[model samples]
Target: MATFRKHGKSIRVEVSKKSNLQLATFDIITQVREWTALAETAIIESKSTDIVSNKTVSDTFERYTEEISPNKKGAR
Candidate 1:
């Protein structure tokens, strides 16, 4: 729950804090929602990048072991 107060012609809003209420609180609410959406987008993008890098590393390791292992031993 956010409390709203008059800030000149605009509204001031804070969550878990008390202030005088004003009709301009609607604008403050809109700004808060926008910030939340931006944060969510960043988190999703980071996860997607991590998934791609992990797959590339696993594939490279498999190739190295397969092609180079045969040439390393000389028991015969």
Candidate 2:
């Protein structure tokens, strides 16, 4: 299940299932809920024992620019 708590301006999301736990924070409630649902589904489906990652903010942005940003309306 996912636990939600208000952390100042952002919302903290904690999802724990089986012997695994995942934590994340988002400024938007919809984002938090979406992530929580996906995490729970992955856990219940036994996708992996560890859902945590070592990804950095810069790496995520780089991936977005390469894979997603180019598909946006302004991309040429």
Per-residue C-alpha lDDT of model 2 across residues 3-50, encoded as one tens digit per residue: 999999999999999889889999999999899999999989999656
Model 1 agreement with the true structure over 1-43: per-residue lDDT tens digits? 4455677766665443122221224456577556445444544
| Model 1 misplaced stretches (Cα beyond 4 Å) | 1-27, 47-76
Q: Give the backbone clash total of model 1.
A: 0
Reference-based lDDT, residue 26, model 1 = 40
Residue range with the least summed lDDT across 10 consecutive positions in model 2? 48-57
User: What are the lDDT figures for the candidates, one per model?
Assistant: 0.50, 0.91
Candidate 1 whole-model C-alpha lDDT, 0 to 1? 0.50
